[model samples]
Target: MTDRKLLLRVTLGWFLLLILAYLNHFQNGFHFDDSHTITYNTAIRNIKNVPAFFSDPTMFSANPQHHHLRPWVTTTLAVDYWLGGGLYPFFFHLSTFLVHIGLCLLLFSVYKEITGNALQHRWAPWIALFAAGVFGMHTAVAETINYVISRSDVWSTFFIVLSLFLFIRFPAKRKYGLYILAAVAGVFAKETVPVLLVLLFFYILFFEKNLSVAQLFTARHFKTVLGVVGRLLPLLLAVAIVQIYTLTRVNTETQDAGLSNPLISYWLTQTYVWFRYFITFFWPFHLSADTDLKVISDVSNWRIIVGVLFVMALLVSIVKTSARKETRPISFGLIWFAASLLPTSLLPFSEVMNDHRMYFAFTGLALAIVYAAGLLVIRRESSVVAHPSYKKAIIFAMALIIGLHAFGVHQRNKVWFTEETLWKDVTEKSPENGRGWMNYGLSLMSRGDYVSALKMFEKANTLLTDYSFLNINMAIANAGLKRNEEAVANFARAIMLAPNDYNSYAYYARYLVEQQKFAPAKEMAEKALSLNKNDIISLESAMAAYQGLQQWDKLKQTASYTLSIDPENTKAANYLAAAHQQKATVALPSSGLKTSEDYINLSLVLYNAGAYEDCIAACRNALALKPDNADAYNNICAAYNMLKQWDKAKEACKKALELNPNHANAPANLKWAENERL
Candidate 1:
C-alpha cells in the first residue's frame, strides 16, 4: 500500500477501535464534580451566559468553593446544554469523547515525529499508531472520559498536543504564532498548560540539539543550553502573560486549592502517588473514582520509601536512555510523564491522588512503552532475519493487550452507568472515603430507600463530622424517616457549618415547604435566591411557598420568572395557571380551620412535624366535618402507624377502605401496620 493510503487505513482502524471501546460510556451519567459544575450550575442553563463565563469566574460552579476561571470549559458546557436542551449526559460525554479522539490523533502525529527522529526506521508511523492506540484505549483514560466535567482535562490536553504537533509538523507556522496561540487557548481550559514549556525544552534538548540529558549540565554545552532557552523565550513569555491574565480573572478566595493536607505531608504522600501512577500505566487495575490513600506524616514510612526509590529509578532510566539517539524518545517520554504530574503534585489537592490525573501523564508513558517494545522487535528481527511469523506474533500480542484494555473500559463504563452504581463502586473501592459513603447514601435516598440511606449517612458522619453537605443529606434522610427533631437539628448544623452556601438554605426551604411552613420556607428560599438567583430549586421552593400562603401576585411573578429561565418547566406553568385562577378567591387565615380539606391539610402538617397526637386530633376533626371522608380516615391510620398503635392503625385503614376502596394511602398504611404487628 502507498504510504498515504496506509496512514488513512490505520487512522480509520484507530477510530473504529476507539468507538468500540467507548461506545458503552457515551450514555454514562455525570459523576462527582459534574454536580457542582454542570448540573447545579445555573450559568450554563442559557447559551447567552457563555460570554459572562469569561468575565465572571464564579459562573464556573454553583458551589462558591469550586469556582475557577475555566471559561472554555464553561463555554463548552453551556453549548452542550443548549444542544441537548437540558442537562443531558450524552451530548456532554460525546463532546468529551470527540476531544479525546482528537487528542489521540494528534498524539499519533506527535509520536510519529518523535519516533522517526529517534530511530530513523520504516516502522515509525506504525509504531506511533500502536502507541496512540494504547493510550486511546487505555483503561486509565476511561476514568477521565467517563467523567463529563473532566472534559477540562481532555480539552486542555488536546490543545497542548495540538501545540506540540504544530511546533513539530509545521516549523514555518512558528513565525505566524499558531503554536503559541494553541498553547494560550489551552490555558483557558486548564491552568496546567504551562507544563508544555518544560516538555518543549526537553524536546529541543534531546531531538534538536542531539545532546544527552547529562550533557546539558556539562560546561561544553552551556552555549547550546542558552540557545535552547532563547528558542523557547517567545512561547515562555506568551504562557506567562496568559497565566497572569488568568490569575486576574479567577476568584482566588473561593478556589479549591487542595490544601486539605499539610504541605510536608502532602509532598510525602505524592511520592507514593507517583509510584501508584507508574504501576497503573503498566497494569491498569483497581482504579477508583475516589481513593482512600492518606498523606504520610512520617518520612521513614515503608510506602514513602518505596515511592522515593521508584522515583530515583525512573530518573536513572531517563538519564541512561538519553545517552543514545535510538533511545531518546524513551527518555523524552519519561520526562513528559513526570512533568505532566508536576502541577497536581506540587500543589496539594483535596485528593492526594485521582485516577483521572493519569490521562495526561499516560500520554508520555504510552510512547515510552511502545517505543521500548519496538526496539525489542527490531533486535529480534535482526537475530532471526527470515522469521516473518515473529512479526505476526508481535501484532497478536499488541492486539490482545488492546482488547483487554477495551474490556476494562467497558467494565468501568458499567460502574459509571448511574449515580447509585458509581457511588456504590466508590464505597467499595474507597471505603474509608467519607464523601463516597455520603454520596452513596444520597443515591439511596434519591431512590426512596431512606432506612438504608440513613445507615450510610451515619457511617459518613462518624468519618466526616463537620461536613456541611453530609449534614444536609443526613437532614434529608432523617426527614424521609419522619425523624423530625433530628432532621431539624441536622439542618441547623448544616446551615451553621456553611452559612454562605445557598444549598443549605435551598434544601431547608424545600423541607419546610413539605411541612406546610410557608412563612419560613419563603424566607429561606428568598435567602437562597439572594446568594444564587438563577437556582431553579430555590425558585420552585419560593413558588411552593407563595402558593401555600395564597399570595397569588407573588406566585404568578415567581412562576413567570422561573419559566423565563427554564422554558420547559411544566410545574412553573401549572403554578402560574393556578395563581391566575386563585387570584379572585379570598385568602383564608391559618387559624381558620372551617372545612374538611383545611383540617386534612392541617393533619398532614402535624404528621410531617412528628406531632402524631395532634395529627390524629386534626384527622378526627376532619372526619366530623365530613363524615365518610376517606382522606381523613387515611390520615388517622398514618398517624396511628407513626405512634405504633398497630391495631388502631389497621382499624382506621379498614375504615378508610370501606369509605373509598381506591384510597391510595390506606393500603400502604395497612400493609405497614400488619408487617410491624408480625
Candidate 2:
C-alpha cells in the first residue's frame, strides 16, 4: 500500500475505534458528581454569571460557602452551557471522543519518529495506532470520559499527547514553543501531568540529546553531557509557580488530605492498583467508581510479592536490553508508565485505586507492549540484539493480551449505565464499603422513599463515623416524619460536627425562623454567610430573617443578590418585590377589587405573625388577583370580622356560600359577623 493510502486507512480505522467508544459511553449517562458538579448544579449552568463560577468555587448563594478552587474545570462547563443548554451530556461526550481520536493520531506520528527506519516505518504507526485505540476505548477510561464533569482529565490527555507529538516533529527546537504551551495547559488539567514533564526532561537529557543550549536544556546526558538547564530553567520556573499555587489551594486543607497508612501499607496497596490496571489492560471487568485495594498489613500479603516480582521483571528487562545495545524505548516506556502514575500512586488521594487514574499511565505500558511487538516483527532487519524464537513468543503473548483486554473493556463499559444501578451493584459486590452505602442513600433519597434512605445513611455512618453529611440528611428524613425535635437535634449535631457545613446551619436556621426565634435565626444566617461568602441558601435565610424583623431594605438587597445568582428563582423574585413595597412604607392595599391569591398567601404569613390588618389587606390583594376566588373571599370575610367590619364581612360570607353551600368556614364566620352587624 502507498504510504499515503496506508496512513488514510490507519487514520480511518483509528476513528472507527473511537466511534465505537463514543457509542458505548454516549449510551451511558453521567455517574458520580455529574449531578451536583455539572448538570443539576445551578452554579455551572447559568452562563451570564460565568465569572462568579471562576471567582468563587462554592456557589451556594452565600459568598462564604465551601467550593473547590478549580476554575479551569468550571470554565469548560460554562462553555458547554453556551453550546448546549443545561442537562445535555451528548455534546460533552462528543467533544471528549473527538479529542480521543486526535490523541491516537498524534501517538502514531510520535511512534513513527521514534522508530526511524524502513522496517519500523510501517510497524511503528500500526503499533502506535493499536496503543491509542486500546487506550481510547479501554473501558477503564469511562470515569474520565463518560462522566461528563471529568473533561478535565480528557483535556489534559489532549495537551500531554499534543506536546509529545510536537516534541518529536522534525527539528525539536521549533516544537519547543508547543511543548511549553502544552505543559502549561496540562498543569491546569490536573496536578498529575508535571510528573510526566519531569520524566520527559530526564528522557530528553539522556536519550534525545542533539546538543545545544536549547537541546542542552532538553538533554539527559549523565555520562557525557552538554546543554541542560537554561532552556529548561524557564519552563521549570513556570511549573514551580503553578505548583506553589496548587499547594496553597490544595495543601492547606490538611485534614482533607486524609489518612495515609504507613508508607509500607501504601506501597503494598499500590501493587494491587498497578496489577489491577495490568489485568484490566488485558481483560476489563465490573469496573466500579471506588475500588478497594488488596491490603498488606504484613509483608505476607500476596500483592506485595506479586508487585515486587513485576517491578523486578521490568528492571531486569531494561538492564539486559541495555547490555544488548537495543535502544532503551521499552525501558523508557516502563519508566513513563511508572512515572506518569506517581501523582496518583502516592499516599492517600481519593482512594487506594481508581481505574480512571490509569488512563495516561496505560500509554506507557502500551508503548512497551507495542515496541516489544515491533522488535519481534523486524527480527530480519538487523536486530541490535536477536532471538527468533523469543520474538515469536512475544508476538503470540501480545496478541493474546490484546484480545483479552478488548473483552475486558467491553464488559466494563456496560456497568456505567446509571448511578442507581452502579451503586446497587457495588453494595451487592462490596457491602462493607462506606462510600457505596452513602451513594445508595442518595439514590434512594432521590426516589423520595425516605424510610429506606434513612436506613442506608445509618449503615453508611457505621463505616465513616462523625460525618455531618449523613446527620444533616438524616434530619431531613425525621422532618418528613414530623419528628421536629429529633430533626432539630440531628441538625444541631451536624452543625457541631462540621462547623463549616453551612447547609445544616442554613436549614436549621430556617426551622428556627418557623419557631419565631428571629434573633437566633438571624444570628445563624450571619454565621453561615460569614464562612461561605456567596452561599445562596444562607442569603435567602438572611433575607427571611430580615423580613421577619421588618428590615425591608436589607431584605430587598439580599433577595435581589440571591436572585442574581439564580435567575430562575421565582420565590426570591417575589420576596424582592414584597421587600421593595414594604421599604416604601406604603399602605398595603386592603380593599383591592382583585389580587385574591396573593392576598391569601400574604394573609397566611400575616395571620401567623398576628397582624390582623395586614392579614386583611393580604386577603383583599388575593381577591383582587382573582375576583371569583371564593376561598379568598371567605378568607377576607374572616379577616374583616376579626377587624369588626361586621356588615361587610357578613355580605362577603354570603357571596362565599353562593359559590358553594359546603363552604363550612363561611357559614360559621357569617353567623359571628351577623351577631355584631351594625
Candidate 3:
C-alpha cells in the first residue's frame, strides 16, 4: 500500500482502538481533584467567568491553595460545564476522551516528523502509528484521561508536540511566529514547556543532522549547531517570559509545604521514580490513582543503585546507537524520555510519584520501544514489507503489546468508576497513605455509612493529624452517630485548625443545630457565609440555624437569598414557607402590625387569627400578584385546612407540593385532608 493510504488507514485504526479502550470511561465519576477543581469550582458555572479565569488565579480551583494561572485548563472546564448542563460527569469524561484522541493524533504527527527523517520517510507512518497507539493505550496515562482536572497535562503536552511539529514542518520565518505562539500556549497549559527548549535543541543536534555532540564539535557541523541554537533563541525567550509569570503566580498562592523532602533528597529519589516510570510504560500492573511511594533518603539504597545503573545503561545505549545511521531514532526516543521527565524530577511535590506525571514522558518510552523494533527489522537487511515472515512477526508483536496496553487501560478506568471505588483502590494499594484513607472515609460518609466512615477517619488520623477538613468530617460522622459531645469537640477543633475554611464552619453549624445550640450555630453559619458568599452549604446551614433559633425574619431572608441563587432549590423554598408560618402562628392577638410585606404574609397572619374567609381572600390576592408563588399555595392550604375545606385544602397542598417539593408541611397536610370525611 502507498504510504499516504497506509497513514490514513492506520490512523483510523488507532482511533477505533482508542474508542473501544476508552468508551467505558465516559460513565466514570469525578474523582480526587475533580471535586475542588471542577465540581465545586464556581468559576466554571458560566462561560462569562472565562475572562476571570485568566485574570484571577483562584478561578482554577475551589481550594485557595491550588490557585494558579492555568486559565486555559480552567476555561476548557468551564466550556465542559456549560455543555454538560451542570456537574454531569459525562461531558467532562467526553472532553477527556476527545483530548486523549487529539493527543494520539498529535503523537502520530510528531513521530512522523521525527522518524520520517531517520527512516528515509519510508516506514514513518507505521512507526508513527505504533508509537501513538502504544502511548494512547498505556495505563500510565489513564489518570490524566479519567480525571477531568488533569487536562492541564493533556493540553500542555498537546501544545508541546504541536510546537515541535510546527518547528519541524515549517522552519521558515513566517512559520516561526506560529511555532512560538504554540510554545507560549504550552507554557500556560502547564509548567513543562521550558523542557521543550532542550527537546528542540536535541532534535536539531541529533535527528535533523543524525550527528552526536562529538561529531558536531569536530569542525564539520559547528556552524549548523550555532544556526540551530540561534533559531531556537526566540522560542526560548518567549518560554522564559511565561515561566516568570507562572512562577510568580505559583509561589504567591502555594500554601502547601514547599517541599516534603530536602531538595537533594528529592532529586536522588527521582532515580527510582524514573525506573518506576519506565516499568509503568512496559508493565503497568501496579497502577494506582493515589500512591504513597516513599522518597529515597539514602543514595546508597539498593533500588537507587539499580535505578542509577539502569539509567546509565540506557544513556550509554543511546550514545552507542546514535553513531549508527539507522539507529538515531532509537537514541532520540531514549533522550526524549529523560528530557520529558526533567521538569517533574527537578521539583519535589507532595507526592513522590504520580501516575499523571508519566502522561507526557511515556510518549518517549513508547517511541523508543517502537523504533527499536523497527531498527531490528532494518538490521536484518530486509525491506520492511519484502520479508513476509519477519513482517508478520513484527505485526503480531505490535498487536500483542497494544492489546496488553488496551486491556490495562480498560481495567484502570473501571477503578475510577466512582469516588468510593477509586479511593478504595488507593487505600488497598497504598495503605500507609493518610489522604487515601481520609478520602475513602469521605466516600463512606457520602454513602451514609457514618459508623464505618468514622472508623476510617480514625485510621487516617493516626497517619495524618491536624487537617481541618478531616476534623470536620470526623465531627459530621460523630453527629451522625449521635455522639454529641464528641461531635462538638471535633467541630471546635476543625474550626480552630482552619478558621477561614467555610466548609468547616458550615458543617460545625449544622452539627450545632442538631444539638439545639441555635445561637452558636447561627454565629458559625454567619461566619461561614462571610468567608464565601456563594457557598451553598453554608447558606443551607444559615437557613437551618435561623429556623432552630426561631429567628423567622433571618430564616426568610436566608431562604430568599438561596432561592435567588438556585430558583429550584426545594430546601430553601421549604425554609421560606416555614419561616412565614412560624411568625404567623406565634404573633400575639393584640399585636398591632401596620402592614404585611406581601399578600402571602397577610394570608398567613389572617389564617392564624381564625379569619378563614379573609385568609382565603388574602391568598387569592397573593396568587393574583404572583401566580406561581409556592408560599401562597401553601398558605391557602393552611387556611382551607383551618376552615374544614377538605377537598380544597388537599388540592392546594398538592399544588404547593408540586411547586415546592421541599414544603415540609404540605405532604402531611395533604394526607390529613385526604383522610378527612366530607
Candidate 4:
C-alpha cells in the first residue's frame, strides 16, 4: 500500500480494536454497580433534575460516599431519558464511546503536532493513529470508559482534550479568543478539566517556548482578535449559560463519603496509591470497583520510598527538560501527567487512584511513551543504515508491542462485563490488593453467595485487616447464612476495628431480635441508632426488637419515628398503628392509610388471615384514595371473590383492567373473576 493508504490502514486497525471493545460491551446491560446512573440517579433521569442538580454540589458530589455524585456526567443520562426511554444504558454507552473516540483523536493530534518536524509529517499520522488507537482500546481505561458510572472521567476527559487541542492550536494560529472560549466550554463539563490550565501552561513552557503562559492568557496583538471573538461568541454564550444555570439552580447537596482522616491523611495515602497506579498502568490485568488500600497515617519506611520517587519524577521532568530546552515538551507532558494527577494524589481528593484520575494524566504517559519510543528509534537509526531486514524488524517490534497491548485490553474488557467478574479478576491479578478482595466479597454478597463472600472478606482481612467495613460485610454474609454466632462475632469485631458508626452492631442486633434476645438486641440497636437515627433498615430492626420485647410504648415511639424518616414505608406505619391498638382507649390508625398503595398492601397482608371484611374495607379505602389504582381495584375484586360476591367482583375487575390493562395482578385476577362470572 502507498504511505497514505498505509497510514489509513493502520488507523483502520486501531478503529477495528475500538469496535471490539464496543462489541464486548454491547450485549452487557448496565450492571447493578452503575445502575443508579440511569434509574435512581436524580440528576440524569430527567430534565426536572437539572434545576436541582445544578443547585446542589452535594447532590452531584462524586466522592467515595453513597455514590460519587456525577451531576454533569449524569445530566447526559437525563437527556437520554427523553431521547430513548428505557434504552438509556444503550445510548449512554454509545455517547461514552463517541466521547472516548473524540478524546483519542485529540491525543493523537497532540502527538502528531509534537512530532511533526521529526519525520517531516511522514510519521505524524501513524504515530497519532497509533496513540489514539492504543489509548482507545487499552484495558487500563475500562473503569473510566466502559463502566457506566465512571462517566465522570469520560465527561471530564472529553472537555480536557477539547480544551487542550483548542489551546494548542491557538498558539500556532495566535487566535486566542476562539479557543480560550472552547477551553471554558470544557470547564463546564467537569471541574477537573480546569487543571488543563496547568497542562497548557506546561505545554507552552516546554514545547511552545516562543509563547509564555501569561502571553497566551492575553493576546491583544493578534491580528484576528475581533474575528476570533466573533467565531467564539456562540461557545462563550453556551458556557456562560451553563455557568449561570449552575450558580442559580445548583446547591452543595452532592453527598460525599465521610472521611475520618485529615487532608494530610489523603496525601499520605497517595504514596501507596501512586505506586499502585504506575504498577496497574504498566500491567492492566486486575481491576476493582473498590480497592482496600491502607492509609499511611504516618510517613514511615516504605512510604518514604514512594514519596521520594514521586518527588524525583516530578523534579527530574521539570529540571531535565527545561535545561535542555529541546526536550522541554516531553518534560512538559511528563510534568503535566504528574501535575494533573496531583489533585487526586492526596492534595485535595481523598481518593488515591481513581481510574478517572488517569483519564487526562494517561495522555501524558502515552505522550511520554511515544516520544521516548520515537527518540529511541531516531537515535538508533542515525548510526545504522537501514536494510530491508532492519525495516521489517522495526515494524515487527512495533506490531508485537501493539498486539500484546490489544490482547491485554481485550482480556480486561471482559472483567468489566459485570461487577463480580471485575472484582474477581482484580483480586486474581492484584493478589496483594486488599481492597480488591473486599470489593469482590461485597459483589459476592450481593448475589446471596455469602459463603464465597466470607472467604473473600477473610482474604481482605488478611491484607488490610484493620478496616471496619470488611468486618461489617463479613457479618452480613454470616447473617445471611443464619450463622448467628459467627454473625455476632464478626459484627463485634467490626465495631472494635473502628469504634464508630458500626454496621456490625445493627446486624447483630437484628439477629438478636430473631433469636428472642431482646435485651441485648435493644442495647446494641440503641447504640447503632445513636450513630445514625435516620438509617431506615436499622430503625426497622430496632423497632421490631422493641415490639417483640413487649415494650409497647417504646415500640410506638420508635416505629412512629421510623415512619417519619421514611414516610413511604407501610411497615413502619403498620407497626405504629398496632402499638397504638394495644391501648384499649386509643383506636389504631386505620390499617390502611391515605395511599392507594398502603391500602393494597394492607389488603395483601390481611388476605391470609381470613380477614375478608378488613381486606375489602382496605381495598375500598385504596379505591377511594386513588380511583384508578389498578392493583387496589384488582385486589378488591379478589376480596369480593373470597366473600362469594361474584357480580361485584366482576365489576371491580373490569375497573382494574380499564385503569391498567397490562397490570400483572390485574390480568390474573381478571381471568379468575371472568371464569367465576361464566
Candidate 5:
C-alpha cells in the first residue's frame, strides 16, 4: 500500500475502534465539573456570550466564583450549544470523539516522520499505527473522553501535539509564528501548554544534531546554547506571558482551599503518584473517576522508596541505552514522559492523582513501547526486511498489547456511563474515599432512594469529616428521612462553613419550609437568591415560603419569574395556580357572608402560623354568619386536627358533610378524625 493509503486505513481503523469502545457513552449525562461548567453556565446559552467568554472568567460558568480563563473551552461549548440548540450530551460526546481522532491522526503523522528517519529505517507506518493505537485505546484516557468538561485536557493535547508538529516541520526562526499560534491556543485551553517549550528544546537537542548534552555544559558550547535560545526566544516569551495572564485570572480562594495540604507533603505524594500513572498505562485495571490517595510525609515509606528507585533506574537505563543509534527514540520517549508529567506532579492540585492527567503523557509511553517493538523486527540495513518469524512474533506481541488496552478502554467507558455507576465504582475501589461515598449518595438521592443515600452520606462523613457540601447533602438526606432537627442543624453547619454557596441556603430554606419554619425559610431563601439570583432552586424555595405565609403577591411574583425563566417548572406552575386561587377566594362572598370568606382566609393564615386555637376561633366566626358553609366547617376541622382534638375534628367533619355531603375533603377528614378520636 502507498503511504497515503496506509495512513487513511489506519486513521479509519482508529476511529472505528474508538467508536465501538465508547459507543455506549454518547447518552451519558454531565458528571461533576460538567454541572458547574456546562449545565449551569447560562452564559453559554447564546452565541452573543462569546465575546463575554473572552472578557470575563466568570462567564465560563454560572457560578460567579468559579473563575476559569479557558475561553477556548467555553467557546467550543457555545458552538456545540449553538449547533444542537441546548445541552445535548450526544453532540458534546461526538465533538470530543472527533477531537480524539484528530489527536490520533496527528500522533500517527509525527511518529511516521520520526521513525522513518531513524538510523535503522523500519516499517515506519506500522510503528506509527501501533503507537497511535495504544494511545487512542489506553483505558486511562476514558476519563478524558467520557467527561465533557475534561475536553479541556483533550483540547490542550490537540494544540500541544499540533505545536510540536509545527516546530518539527519548521524549525527555522521565520516560521515561529505558526508555532506561537498553536502554543497560544493551547494556553487558552489549559495552562500546561508552556511545557511545549521544553518539548521543543528536547526535539532540537536530540533530533537536530545540534550541541550534545556534555558539550553544552562546558564553556566552549556557551555560544551554541545562546544561539539556540535566541532562535526560540520569541516563542518562549509568548508562552510565558500567556501563562502569567492565565495564572493571574485564576480564583485564588478556590485554588488555595483545594491545595490545603502543605507544599512539601503534596510533592512527596506525587512520587508514588507517578508510579501509579505508569502502571495504569500498561495494565490499566485499577481506575476510578475519583481516587483516595494519601500523602506520604515519611520519605522512607515503601511506595515512595520504590518510586525513587524506579525513577533512578529509568534515568540510568535511558542514558546507558541512548549510545546505541536504535535506542534514541526510547531515550527521547522516556524524557518526554518525564517532562510531560513534571507540571502535574510538581504542582499541588485538588486531586493527588487524576486519570485524565495521563492523557498527554501517555503518548510518550506509547512511543517508547512502539519503538522498542520496532527494534525487534527492524534489520540494520535500511533496504532489508526482517525474517518472517521475527516479524510474526513482533506483530503478535503488538496485537496482544493493543488488544488488552482496547478491551480496557471499552470496559472503562461503562464506568463513566452515569454518575451513579461512576461513583459506585469509586466507592467499591476506594472505600475510604469520602468524596466518592458522598457523590454516590448524591446519585442515590437523584434517583429518590433517600434511605440508601443517607447511609452513603453517613459513611462519607466518617471518612471526610466536615466539608460544607457534605453537610448540605446530609441535611437533605435527613430531611428526606423526616429527621427534622438533625437536618436543620446540619444545614446550619453547612451555611456556617461555606456561607456563600447558594445551594446550601436554598436547600436549607426548602427543609425549613417542610418543618413549617416559614420565617427562617423565607430569610434563608432570600439569602440564597442574594448569592445567586438565577438559581432555580432558590427561587422555588422562596416561592414555597411565600405560599406557606399566604403572601399571595410575593408568591405570584416569584412564581411568575421562575416560570418565565423555566416554563416547564411544575413547582412554579403549582405555586402560581395556588396564588391565583387564594386571591380569588379572598375576593369572594361579595354581599351577605363576605365576612365568612374573610374569616376563613384568616383561619388559614393562623393555621400556617401554628396558632391552632386562634385558627379555630376564626373558623367559628366564619361559621356564625354562614352556619351551613362547608369550607368554614372544613377549616375548623383542619384546625382541630392540628391540635389533635380528634373529637372536635370529627364533629366539625360531620357538620361539613351535613352542609355539603360531597365536600371534596370531608370524607378523608371524617376518616382521619374517626381513626384518631380520643
Candidate 6:
C-alpha cells in the first residue's frame, strides 16, 4: 500500500478503537463539579450569557466558592446547553469526547515529529501511531473524558500540543505568531497552559538546536543556550501578560481552592502524588475519582523519602538520556511529563491528586515508552529484525496492550455511568474520603432512600465533622426522615460552618418552604439570592414562599424575574400564571367539613401555617368523625410538638404509632417530645 493509504487506514482504525472504548461513556451522567458548573448554573442556561462568561468570573459556577476564570470552558458549556436544549449529559459528554479525539490526533502529529527527530527509522510513523493509540485508549485519559468539567484539562492540553505541532510542522508560521496564538487560547481554557513556555524552551533546545542536556552547563555552549532563551523571550512575554491578566481578573478571594494541609506538608504530599501519577500511567487499576491519600507531614516518612528518591531517579534518567541524540526524544518526553505536573505540584489545590490529572502527563509518557521500545526493535541484529515470527510477536504484544487499556476504559465508563455508580465506587475505593461517602448518601437521598441515606450521612459525619456540605446533606437527610429538631440543628450548624456559602441558605429555605414556614423561607431565599442572584433553586424557593403566604404581587415579581433569567423555565411560567389567577380575597367554603379525610387535610394546612391550636382542633374533629383515624392523631401530635406541648405531643404520637406502626412522622415526633420534656 502507498504511504497515504497506509496512513488513512491507520487513522481510521484509531478512530474506530477510540469510539468502541468510549461508547459506554457517552451517556454517562455528570459527576462531582458538574453539579455547580452545569446542573445548577443558570448562566449557561441562556446563550446570551456567553459574552458575560468571558467578562465575569462568577459566571463559571452557581456556587461562589468554585468561581474561576475559565471563560472558554463556560462558553462551550453554554453552547452545549443551547444545542441540547437543556443540561443533557449526552451533549456535554459528546463535546468532551470530540475534544479528546482532537487532542489524540494532535498527539499523533507531535509524537511523529519527536519520533522522526530521534530515530530516522522506517517505523517512526507506526511508533507514533502506537503511542497515540496507547494514550487515546488509556484508562487514565478515560477519567478526564468521562468528566464534563475536566474538559478544561483536555482543551488546554490540546492547545499546548497544537502550539508544539505548529512550531515543529510550520517553522515559517512562527513569525506570523500562530504557535503563540495557540498558547494564548490555551490560557483562557486553563491557567496551567503557561507551562507551554517551559515545554517550548526544551523543545527548541533538544530538536531545533540539536543541543545535549550536558552542553547547557558546559562553558562551550553557553552562548547557544542564551540564543535559545532570546528566541523564547517573545513567547514568554505573551504568556506572562495573559497569566497576569487572568490572575487579576479572577476573584481569588471567593474561591475555596486552598488545601487544608499546611504548605510544607502539602508540597511533601505532592512528591508522593507524583509517584502515584507515574505508576498509574503504567498500571491504572487503582484510579479513584476521589482518593483517600493524606498529606505527609513528616519529612522522615518512608513514602516521602521513597517519593523523593523516585523523582531524583527520573531526573537522572532524563539527564543521562539527553546526552545522546538517539535518546533525545526520551529525555524530552520525560521533561514534558515532569513539566506538565509542575503547576499542580507547586500550587496548593484542594485535591492533592486526581486521576484526570494524568491526561496531560501521560501524553509525553506514551511517547517515551513507545520510542524506547522502537529503539529496541531497531537495535536488534538484522536476522532478528527480519524474522517474521519476531515481527508477529511484537505486533501481538502491542495489540494486547492497547486492547487491555481499551477494555479498562470501557470498565471505568461503567463505573461512571451514574451518580450512584460513581460515588459508590468512590466510597469503595476511597472509603476514608468523607466527601465520597456524603456524595453517595446524596445519591441515595435523591432516590428517596432516606433511611439508608441517613446511615451514610452519619458515617460521613464521624469522618468530616466540620465539612459544611456534609452538614447540609445531613440536615437534608434528617428532614427527609422527619426528624424535625435534628434537621433544624444540622441546618444551623451548616450555616455556622459556611456562612458565606449560599447553598446552606438555599437548602434551608427549601426545607422551610416544605414545612409551610413561608416568612423564614422567604428571608433565607432572599439571603441566598443576594449571594448568587443567578441561582435558580433559590428563586424557585422564593416563589414557593410567596405562593404559600398568598403574596400574589411578590410571587408574580419573583417568578417574572426568574423567567427573565431562564426563559424556558416551565416552573417559573406556572408560578406566574398561578399568581395572575389568584384573587386578593377568596371566599372560604360555606359548608363545614363533613368527612374525616376533609378535616384531616384541613389540619395539615393549619399545621403547616403555624396555627397549632387550630390544627389540633381540626385533628380532634377528624377523630370525632372517624375514631380510628391514625392520620388525625399524627397531625395532632405534630401540632402539639410545634406548640411545645411535649406531654400531649408524646401521648398523641404513641396513640398514632399504636394505630399505624408504619406512621412515618409519629415516632420522630414522639422522640422529640420526650427529649424536650427531659
lDDT of each: 0.86, 0.65, 0.78, 0.65, 0.78, 0.85
Give one digit per residue, the lDDT tens place, for model 2 in 553-667: 7876786576555544445545665675664232333432123454566566555444556556556545544667677768778878878899888988999888878986889
Total clashing residue pairs per candidate? Answer: 1, 43, 0, 22, 0, 0
Candidate 4 lDDT, 1-678, residue by residue in tens: 799888867777877767764567654456534643454333453355665554455344222134332456656766765466444456777777787877887778877776562345355566666656656766677667667656667777777776767666556654545555555555546546546656654555445444323333456524333444555455456556655654444433423334445677677667566666666656765465555454567666587568668767767655655555435445666766677777566444444456656666777767666666666666677443556677678778777766777676566667777678877877876677777888888888989898998899888889876887788888788889988788788877888886655356777677787778888888889887776555555677787777777787897788656644334455665666556554213232454254567667767755654556656766775776577788887878887888878888888888988998887776777677778778
Determine which window of 10 residues in candidate 3 has minimal summed lDDT: 588-597
TM per candidate? 0.83, 0.73, 0.80, 0.65, 0.79, 0.84
120: Cα error in model 4, Å: 4.5
What is the per-residue lDDT of model 1 for residues 17-134, given as tens digits with 9 covering 90 to 100?
A: 7798889887888778898898878678778887888778888887766778889999999999878867788899999988998899899999999999988777788889899999
Give the C-alpha miss distance for residue 492 in model 5, angstroms. 2.1
Clashing pairs in 3: none
Off by over 4 Å in 6: 2-4, 381-383, 580-678
Per-model root-mean-square deviation over C-alphas: 15.5, 12.3, 10.1, 9.1, 15.0, 16.2
lDDT tens string, model 6, 1-678? 987688779789768988998888878998999998988887897787888877788888888778888889999999998788677889999998998898889889988988888888788888898889899999888899999999999999999999999998999879998998999888889988878878888888898888878878999889988998898888888988987776677677777776566788888878788888888888999888999887778999999998888899899989998988889888988889989999988877777888888899998889887888888887874756679888888878988988899899999999999999999999999999988899999999999999999989989988898988888888898898899999999989999998998889999999999999999999999999988777888999999898888898898788768866665555664566566556323222233344677667656655654557756866876786689898988889888888899999999999999999998888888899999999
Task: Pick the lDDT winner.
Answer: 1
Candidate 5 lDDT at 377 equals 52
What's the CA error at residue 567 for candidate 2, in Å? 3.2
